[model samples]
Target: MRAIMGLDPVGAITRSVEAFLVALLMVFAVACEQAKLPNLLLISLDTVRADHCSAYGYGRSTTPVLEALSAEGIVCDAAYSVSPITAPSHATLFTGLMPQTHGLRVNGERLSDFGLTLAERLTAAGYQTAGVAGSFVLNRTFGLDRGFEFWDDYFPAEGSKHPSSEWMGHEVPAGFDRRADQTTEIAADFLRDSRDPDRPFFLFVHYFEPHGPYVPPDRWRKDFPCDQGSSELESMVSAYDAGLAFTDDEVGRLLKVLDEMGSTEDTIVIVTADHGEGLMTHGAMAHGQHLYDEAVRIPLMFRWPNRLAEGRKLAPAVSLADLAPTILELLGINEGAQEMDGRSFAPWLLSPSVEGVTFPVFMFRGKVRRAVVEKRWIEGERFGVLDGQWKFLTSESEEDELFDLEADPKERMNLASSYPQEVERLELLLNPWVRMKSPTDGSGITLSLEERQILEALGYGF
Candidate 1:
């Protein structure tokens, strides 16, 4: 071949081929590194209020394990759930969509098939998926088990008898839910034996404790004793704290299993809650009645050794819906994250510092038979929007209520009347999201008679 510009054409072709091969090798190396995805262990504590946890600065050592994990992970200070109910909150967590979009409005309702879950995404990405649910509410029948290769939702039959210490007079229906210890055992077994050693795994462990009718085991209850003549609510509150301690211990056990398997360093451990308990915050003993901080704010912590910064706390508020997208992004999967309602916080986690970050978190609570609205009784759907410091709440049958959460975290004073301009401003933010149509009409799955009874016993009567 004739040389071009006094250069040998053969030499030029050889150099170009070498450069191209080097580039291809570099790309292959990057691809191989990306393929080494970390295992995921997501532990969801049902009805665990953020403020009550020791890691969140509670007076009691209620969550020592969470405290330890926070010391070695990133803690999200202002994390809220999309809905205060179990099914809806979990749906949002798994799908990165709001309850309105996911179509799981309440506890007894099933999740619509329209959305993809975190498990499904991880499974598609070549991860072995398994889930252990502590309660019947998350049973496979509810469609929360779509992508879990091994879903453990088994419960004892209704007529099965148990010791009084186990039930604790809370009327937790037999076969309705498993204790945190039982759930931990099942999850540990999966980690030890069931999971395939050759594939990365996504293990979801749900612990249903301190939900309602707080029934901590005898040992945990002894740690928090009520006064001789304390009020009924006071006693229940003590028991709730004890239940949190018990759940924390079980979480420690599960983590120990990961340690024994030598996967702790290579696994991402995220501990959070589906939703928080009302804990008599707004004259409600349980949740699903209001969207107060006590009922909506949850504990969110993530631990990945050497991969994510340790002992870092992010100040900005995030919603449960943000979790699925965040996990996918962390695992280098950006396929469908853009369509989700939640944006990932992975950038913030990797960055040295981020300031003045405030996410506008939306919340919804369907009308219950009786809900505390403006300190009075009302029955209507309540919608709320929290943008930075201002949080505005509105309902179909009551006046709008606004609170400066920065000034008053308890949300005791409603500044809506005093600050009419702010109310109007936040209403502008709330109305649009409230009007968004759901992907599915409603939870199309009908509840069997037994399921209905179980839900009613769990205080989710239809």
Candidate 2:
């Protein structure tokens, strides 16, 4: 058995009225004679910032399909991820365990087999499980493909060889990622070809567009004209938005397939992102370097047609870890087989009056940085505590500064000396959370020389 180290802070809500409402909703659902278990479809948009989506009020129309889906579902307004990187963030999203407990904090590390996965639990309960991932980071070698009967990482596909260092312009072996279309086609084919119609199924589809190397489709690329030679930042944003538009169209295709199968109403569709990209926000091109809002905050939307409340937006600090447990709770599965760190937030979906409860959201970036964010308080790295509208951050050189996020989302104001007591209060909370020990220590994983090179190229400090 794989050993886990220690636990971290997680959300725990106990409301009697919410419990009653959930019971009533379940009874009503059974009374309506719906399927014993609804099919589950989880769509993860890689490196998509919540603010970029039109559903989240972005100025541009990047996610029309998702915006339409939001009308038929519930949108979590403030969803934070455990890590800004790909693998670790997805790990927490799958197992409902933080990076510290799952032992996959970095990009190249594998999730422990001992940790029970959402797919494993669903598969054990007789759901036909399959996953199609666009990025090479989620290959079976990462230990996240355990229970999926068919895990497609696109490595065996034609022209899908790992890129050589010279060709990739990096010394490390770069992974080969298929475009969103290939992933959607494969997933759609799986849905079309599944032999067992009666058995409920769970499908996980990952889209890697807009991650880095943000090259959208040719048609999408044409939407943003750089003829005048705009700033590099403008070019990057347009390319990212174009990729999102492409991904959105593919998402529509997947939903259309479900509609054609007559499972659209009976299926629970969850659309979310693993982590958001830093488009020059806080001075970063990509993710995994900082714990800022653009890096950790993501879009979490759930649609079940008539089953869940439609067009409802909840403002709460929800974590990526809550996904697995919430799915289990909705499916009426007893997940006591293994202890899970995440609690189900199914109540939020069942009742409209049940507001999103505020909870402390923790973040970890490798071993050098840790953060704790609540509704108002956000403390991490050089950026210390940001409570209510005021934010206090310390530089790497130990200089303290502060800003009012409401007035200065750009973080320009330095109110550290002005409000010394607030700084002391937030630091009191940050110190203990940051000092918490991680569960496992396998930073020295024995990787082959080629694997080590690949990790290095991906910016792992191995």
Candidate 3:
């Protein structure tokens, strides 16, 4: 201060203040960049079919809410799930591993902790992870709750009660799951209360309204018109649509909660299904039977308003298995993750299309059936492969059949005898997957009577 080397002290002080302001601006910029990453919201609709949704051009407005969301998101025209059941398909979605690799092929089987789950990676990266399962099939017992910090799979306050007389004699716990409304309430409350405003969060909300026993409330019943009210199949189909409507309303509620939390525009929301319902399409009611389009083809939508383009429909085939890696990669936290069976579709999410990438989606069930669905989705009793327009199927109970999917969308004609070479060629490709055994055979897992009854009610023979 003693003459300050003949310099102006005011100028030096001004320069110091300028440097501090610049550093402060840099800090603010870093915080703003982190905010752009977006929170993750995964909405899984159980037993929902791609064709039944209005977004997929169904005559009935089964999913008006979903259709609106689709308008703001990228919809995959053809997306397949690994299993026609709940647990296996969900396991695939969480772990990005096929049934063969994860070794939880059948229902009531626990998902192995061998593979890393999407929640685990995100949690390690400081994300708050939580899940609210609508059905007991995804309850904590199944090991699907490995990474979730707040797993909400508890039965309602009424407690677990057997569904009906069909489940009376079984010794399994009455896993009577809650309705879509209750599930939505839990999810919304979590969004409003549990999450820290500054941190990113990953929440999975599952709705089981359309899974089975399609009993829609009176308010949602009139959306579908059945020609014959007395016909069981028609009534079932109508109720299924009503159930979808109910679930759609719940989805809208969830979105509104996100908006209230000021995260709607900054959230990456995914709306898809574990699998699809049969609806008498393949002579089955619920899922867990065959691998038809009605059973495996599910609606997949990804919405990130600021980042993803609006109203884009992607035609490339994708599997539910792509979910984990896609989320991890998009959030920039995929380092040190185990090798995943399904590659990330993150590039396709950002761009219009990714060329020369034909992702092979494998399907497995029991010890007997395996399928390789690429280019086209083809399924039969045992094993099938679709190449271009040709579809070939081989089974022990049924004769090997082949059909031109381009011509026979309903699979009315069997061309196996006419095209023997194609059947052999396709079976050759499916053989390896068929032979891949479950890491631990699930046939012997003794289910409690209530668990057994629940699976039976869900249309599982075991």
lDDT agreement with native, every candidate: 0.83, 0.75, 0.77
Instruction: Show pairs that collide, candidate 1.
Output: none
Alpha-carbon deviation at 435 in model 1, angstroms: 1.4
The best candidate by lDDT is 1
Native-to-model Cα distance after best TM-score fit, residue 288 in candidate 2, in Å: 1.3
lDDT of 2: 0.75
User: Against the true structure, what is each candidate's TM-score?
Assistant: 0.86, 0.78, 0.84
TM-score for model 3?
Answer: 0.84
User: Which portions of model 2 miss their true places by more than 4 Å?
Assistant: 1-35, 156-162, 165-175, 336-338, 367-407, 410-425, 428-432, 442-462
lDDT of 2 by residue, 363-427 (tens): 66663443332222223333333345554544343356656667776565667788888777655
Per-residue lDDT tens digits of candidate 3, residues 166-199? Answer: 2223233555587888899999889988887767
Candidate 1 residues 1-462, lDDT tens each? 356458797888999999999999999999987789999999999999999999999999999999999999999999998888888888888888878778778776778888688888889989999999888778776799988899998766542223232331233334777788888989999988898987899999998887776878899999999889999888999999999999999999999998998999999999999888877778878888888899899999999999888898989988888888889988889886866777787887778565456668889996578645437886767898888899888888766889999899999998988998898877766665566557588534354565555434422222
Which pairs clash (backbone N, Cα, C closer than 3 Å) in model 2?
Answer: 5-439, 6-439, 384-393
lDDT value for candidate 1?
0.83
Count of clashing pairs, candidate 3? 7
